[model samples]
Target: MQQISINTPALLFPAITLLMLAYTNRFLALATLIRNLHTKYKQGQEDRNLLRQQIKNLRRRLLLIKQMQASGITSFFCCVLCMLFFYIGYEGWAYGIFGLSLGFLLLSLVLSLNEIYISTKALEIELKDME
Candidate 1:
């Protein structure tokens, strides 16, 4: 494998940070929705079946978000480790760690896409309830 400069892994810093920020936003939004749903459920304002479906969807989305955050964080950690290894003259180790970083980032993105799909479905459920 060709030797890579520490700059290669350093480049992922901003991108990974931004991805983490976005994931946090998604988590916060989900939290808000769950809280609102809890209120509605307590008040008995929502249909039982509708509430049940929404709860299920939200639970799935919440788990996905958790997974996404974990993957993103692992990716970031690996990226930093790659840079550290390269800095210390372990080029081969750096390369392998960088590969792990990229793999984790890809997994995070796929999980994000799945979460988005589920989020849209939740919206559809709400729309159907309104109809």
Candidate 2:
């Protein structure tokens, strides 16, 4: 294996930071939606079954976002560790850690995509009511 410079893993720092920011935004938006739904439910404005279905969708999406955040954080930590191992002259370990970081980042992205899909389904539910 080619010896990698510490800078190699350091390149992921910005990308991971941006990904985490996006995930946080998604979480915040979901929280606001849940709060509004709770208020509406309390006011007895929306149909019970519709509200229940939306809540279920939100629950799944929240779980996906949590998993995404966890995976992204793990990736970020692994990237830092990869850099540390490279600086200490452990080329093989650095390579392995870098691989793990990439894998985790991939997992995070997959989870994010799944969450987006579920979010769209929620929107569709709302649209159906409008029709």
- Model 1, residue 93: C-alpha shift (Å): 0.6
Clashes of each: 0, 0
Model 1 segments more than 4 A misplaced: none
Candidate 2, residue 64: the lDDT equals 99
Q: Looking at candidate 1, what is the lDDT of residue 53?
A: 97
Question: Candidate 1's residue-wise lDDT over 20-104, tens digit each?
Answer: 9999999999999999989988998989999889989999999999999999999999999999999898888899999999999
- Report the C-alpha lDDT of model 2 over 1-131, residue by residue, as the tens digit: 67568998899999999999999999999999999999999899999989989999999999999999999999999999999898888988899999999999999999999999999999999999999
Give candidate 2's error at residue 114 in angstroms.
Answer: 0.5
Candidate 1 lDDT: 0.94
Q: What is the C-alpha RMSD of each candidate to the true structure, in Å?
A: 0.8, 0.9
The C-alpha lDDT values of all candidates are 0.94, 0.95
Clash pairs for candidate 1: none
- Candidate 1 steric clashes: 0
The candidate 1 region of ten consecutive residues with least summed lDDT is 1-10
TM-score list, all predictions: 0.97, 0.97
